[model samples]
Target chain A: MLKDFVKNIGYDDPLEIYLSKLEKLLGSEYGISKRAVSLLLLQEDEEIFELVKKNEGDKIGVISAIIREANSHYSNPLSYIISERRQGEASRITNSVMSVKEKGLFNFKETLSRLMMNPFIGGPILLAVMYYGLYKFVGNFGAGVLVDFIEKRIFDAHINPFMVDLVNRYLPYELLRDLLAGQYGIITLGARYAFAIILPIVATFFFAFAIIEDTGYLPRLAMLIDQLFKKIGLSGRAVIPLVLGLGCSTMATMVTRTLPTKRERIIATLLLSLAIPCSAQMGVILALLQNKPLGLLIWLGVIIGVFLFVGYLASKIMPGELPSFYMEIPPLRLPQLSNILRKTGSRLKWYLFEVLPLFIFASVLIWLGQITGVFGFLVKALEHPVRWIGLPAQSSVAFLFGFFRRDYGAAGLYDLKTAGLLSGNQLVVACVTLTLFLPCVAQLLMNIKERGIGVGIIMSTFILFFSFSVGYFVNLVLILSGINL
Target chain B: MRKIAIVGSPNVGKSVIFNNLTGTYADVSNYPGTTVEVYRGKCKIGGEEFEVIDTPGMYSLLPISEEEKVGRSILLAESPCVILHVVDAKNLARMLMMTLQLLEAGMPVILVLNIFDEAEGLGIDIDLDKLAKELNIPAVKTVGTTGAGMDILRGKIEEHVKRFC
Candidate 1:
């Protein structure tokens, strides 16, 4: 019935001309309306064109001519004209049925939502959120206080010693004892790191994230930062993955599927793997640079610079049109405390379950490497590049640990910083280098899962070289400038 | 078996309606693209069992992203008995264009004006019966999150299937 109404509206003349051209050029009986197919073809919609071109081989020329004739009738592109007509009809129909009631204003929520999207005010608001929610709350309170209570009071003071004694008593073999209770042992190191350090940091970060997300601040943040992002070949929507990358890069890489274009996804994935350090790394970096503002700034500058430079370069190198950005701006509301807590708890529970096994596996791998002397050999190989970046040979262990888990490298760095092995400048360089390092094992696997293995391997190799090279340059520049922190 | 596929852009209460219809868990969150995979369950309306498919959010039939592709594929292949184009009532103007696209594709679409409570609070009131007449398809206003107007929606769905099917 609707088709009859449309047919009676006299599109038949233009459509018939299109069909004849289609039949003449393609010579097939696909019977699909040529005008619609031609319009789709004009918009460079590949799938329909391929279908029509395959079926209507000889008549394709006629279809082209008909499309050309229709094109000539409008100054604007036919696709745009067609879509506008459809949209106009939609609006006309909607207008006829929908009415507006004059009511009291929702002025308060409107004003607050507006304030969040305003660049001038939103910038400072963002910083305040980051400072309190992330730095002070997550870093200082969760990582500092909770980690100290768990790692020192519970594990170091009690569990490690108890586990060592138990292993020595039960497992008489030296190898088994070392595997379970030594410095790199599964029980002593991995379990501790997973529960004591990573758990608290992740829990806090998720708590903060939930609050921010529930308030609908993220889309507003995206809108606020859209212009700055355009310079880096991304739009505001990319900010979702980037910010989530701070929580977990592996998850963020999966989320990059939301990006409209292949180019955008690759760019986002690359930026995520290189510049955006995950929550674990961020916590350790924050702790490492807690008192060193200069070091923090230098580290921040290097990562941001690499993120922009590489993103710009990737956008140029990748063969695709840049995607236009359009996203809905959601209204902001006061976050419910219970919702925030529940979300954070669930997320933290998920994170812990995922990371605990990996952490233990990493520790077992390290133990195996140590027993076989492969760990020493790999560290020796890493020493060359370590020296190139002016970092000590021992930092190779952290870099080695980094391949297994970013948080492990961060834990290594934290240990190093505590031992007074690295100076302020060295700490800055290490944090910058490690933060820009390849994502953890899970992220690597996820990248392979999302993008093919070849792409994943290529991405990892590029990140490894790029991160170290950037570190080398930063160190060189700092040395030349003689601004020793 | 008959099927009703709920389709729309993300975060427009499709999941809420799906849950209300099927009484299943779908992890309804306040974010978009959370429902990445299609979820299907049974809905019994008027002593008739219908399968309800909750698709990944999609902006249009012309897909640009993976999730949208998933949503579009479900529509094209499954050919549901009724396509519930669930859209945010507050953003009706922008969203109705997709409704137009769905109708143009000759799919059996029922326009669901979701989040109508919020839309009403924002001063918008939709005349559902009039909208049904204009679009030549069933139109229902719902606040899915709160289960408002759900009985009417079910009634409309049953009536639509009885007449059209």
Candidate 2:
């Protein structure tokens, strides 16, 4: 009844003829009109190409010829030509139907938004925001005071002792009691790490991220970083996933699918798995380095250096066109408090559900390994790398925990640092190596899912060895220079 | 039952419009590229039930990313009774490329100039009647966040469904 009531694109005669020809050859029906499918094919849409090749076997040569003819007539790519023509028509319609009132009171949001995109201004503003939002809020308060209170006051003084005593009194079996509430018990290590150490860190991070995200500042950050990013073989578009990686790398790995090219996805996945530290690890690292300013600076320097060096090298090795970025920057707004709270709430729920089980599971695996002597061997294997990096052999446990989760390893470091086992040089080296370590197992699996098994395994292996080498090099440099930190 | 699918470029208020129309929360955020999944909800207009699918923001018919591919596939598969070609009102020229594509596909699309208030605040005024007449389809302006112009939109949806479905 409504056959072509609203006219489609006003295609020129040649294109219209080609569409009809392609329509007839399409043979089987796609859910959409063959006209649309033909347009997609002209644009060289890969999935549509596969669909057409499968559905319209012998007729493919003729369709390709038609597309080739169309391409010859246009200097621009067909996709560009098509969109440009559509835009021209849309402008014509919009010009006739819309008017500007010209009341143009300059909005403050507009000025602020422009300021945020200017590199000179935006860089300083970004630093300030990070210092206050992440350093002060998440690191100092969340990981420092909050974690100290929860891990020491709440758990150490009360919960762990209570649980241990309760288990000892109730369970006569020594192994069962140890499994339940021993030194590395599920109750003591796993739940404590989840609730006491990592929780406050990520809670504060998500809160800060929600507010930053809600204010629509990330795109501006992208614009500011575009110049720097290009040098690393990524365009500004890579900023979104990389910034989000600061929140959680597993989620960020999944988010990499939003990148325009498979090459971009691979580069992004590789970079994220290596240099980007998730929120929990970031906060904990920051808190650890807070007292040692020199150590913190060294760690920061090493990470940025590795990020640039490796990215530049990878871009050179990988064969792909340089990424061209076009992004929409939403108008900055005062973040709604209600919305921020809801975002934080939802993210916290997601984080807890994801990590809490792994925390407990890692605990069980460790306990089982200890009973079977596998844990000792694994730690022994890790001790060589730890010692090579100038860290104590006991720090090997932290490296072992790194396989489970980044933050779990950091929490282990927190324990070692509190026990005064690592020096200033050792602390800086440890933070650098761990920050560059392969992301958690979930992220590893996500990498395989997104980038396939070969790339995934290869990337992870590279990350593992590269991280230790960087640590060893840093340690060597510091020792040779006789640096205090 | 009839169906309406909301489609457009990212950061336009498609998800907000979908939420306001269907009263379903689908994570409306200021950032684009956040929604990597599709959302669907059942809505009722004019005493008849309808299914509304909220697609990921697609830039054009041509797919650049997985999200756009998913968005295009949803539109192709659902064959919704009405497609709301939601656009950022301020950038109507860039957004309407997809609208033209939908029209070319012979889909019943209603041009929704969303973020209407912000566009007006920027001194941009759109003539709904003239746009509707020019396009030969319903055109409505909506500030999806504030629920402004929702009633007229609902009316247009019902009219479109009654005529087509």
Candidate 3:
């Protein structure tokens, strides 16, 4: 058996003597070797120490004394001393077997990798990537082109009409027919949004995200952004979850578990919920603002301002140790097409399964509320705020849809746009408010699950008021300035 | 049936190797920290069934982040029959330290030099036999993406299981 001749990583003579002495006292029943337990004890691993204490009664004091003695022998911690010795042995073995052939010149990947992390060069590169990958590809092609084809040519022209006609002819009960295919029906609204609007947008976003992921560009981007993140009380490592939030905030909220500090996790979660609109909502917003470049820029400016301003305030409010950043910069490589497609396919499958049912469920709930007249009352209540923000009363319906899902609300706005209900100014304001609106039901559950219920509720409440307040202000500014946009 | 657990630093193709061995897919990406949870699948090796575990990436026995803690917990608690210490071939020296720690723990370890093609592209040549002897364990070269060297890896796993398990 391999354990018979376990490779003994040699430490200093005193440390080795201490290790053997500690090893003599440890219980033999541990899953790992006694020597490893002793080594972990010497390194002051609290969990291992507790485990040893639990098993080896009466020997705890002796182990503690020996660890202290070992500590006295070294200025550095025993963990560093042990790891350094292990590294030395590793280097020795690696040197004995590995050879590097020197190249002449022009290491293109190395050069490009450096450029990617360089502060002066990295910003523009990041912008260009966003412009092309997100704006041009996901926004224009996915939301604009693909969404138009699916929503207009397929769902609106073919499926919705056919389903409504079928329901009208076959179903005797008006309520049942309305639930199936009438206004705010499951097939007409929910299935249409899921299949026609969200599908293409999320699929394209995941494809672009997968390609970016496989190219090993994220770490470099992280390093470049670390300084800015530090100011916001997050390490460069937080970039992973924050970036993932763009695809889906629910998953990204779960991914925050990877962060080292609770402070960082909470901050990251708050930002994801409030500012980082998921791909589906973002796609709709981009499409809404596609013809108005100035409006798009203003929307971008306000959301970014809110992101930084809120982050800075949160950092100041929370008391914790500042996060330190460290991440591995894997070498840049060409992404394999097969792998990219597989990843995109799996992500799309996951997104659809997670979202499709919710969309349909939201429709059923809305239909129920309508039959009971509760939906009209809620929309009427919402109309007050909707009008205060200078939006038409019809916009209240979209605001109500916003609670089910951010993208659902945006999809409502899209319907409004197609109906020629909203003006340019109203469109931008609606987009901004919806983008900063409450996280969806799934993300809310995730927030409570990841962070405790208290923090999750508090965050949601703050976001609920802040979003509308910001909308009100944006609308006020637009009216006062008389920009008409 | 015995168990085979694969552990490594993030993005070293542990999931890829796990998929190859188990004939199932786990999320494999170039970026680190994707596999934040454990993945388990069944595999048949040399007429023997094995439970193969794909763990979150960890740097060393001493864990810092939450995922690393999960990785270490699986190793120290589950006690698999064969521990595949997967490492990136391009960064052998830095990664091999964890291999040494795994060995010191007296776990049954097989060093996997994954991403072997990329290392070769960078003009780094590894003497695999010497690496095996130097570490006093079987070492396998693998391109996890393409499943190269997988047969030899399976052979090595079968040999280890027959001898130890």
* Tens-digit lDDT track of model 2 for A414-475: 89998988889999999999999878989999999999999999999999999999999999
- For model 1, fnat equals 0.34
CA displacement after TM-score superposition, residue B94 of candidate 1 (Å): 2.2
Chain B: TM-scores of all predictions: 0.97, 0.97, 0.98
Ranking by DockQ: 3, 2, 1
Stronger candidate by DockQ (2 vs 3): 3
Q: Give the CA lDDT, 0 to 100, for residue B15 in model 2.
A: 82
**TM-score between model 1 and native:** 0.86
Q: Give the TM-score of candidate 2.
A: 0.94
Please tell me the TM-score of chain A for candidate 1: 0.85
CAPRI class of candidate 1: acceptable
Candidate 3 versus truth, CA RMSD in Å, comes to: 1.5
**Reference contacts recovered by each candidate, as fractions?**
0.34, 0.69, 0.76
lDDT of each: 0.80, 0.87, 0.91
Per-residue lDDT tens digits for candidate 3, residues A300-336, read 9999999999999999999799988778888898998
iRMS of each prediction: 4.2, 1.8, 1.4
Better lDDT candidate (1, 3): 3
What lDDT would candidate 2 get against the real structure?
0.87
lDDT of 1 by residue, B1-165 (tens): 988999999888788899899986564556676577788999999999999999988876667788788887676567687889999999887898788767655667788899787788878878877877777777888887668989999999898788776
lDDT of 1 at A191: 87
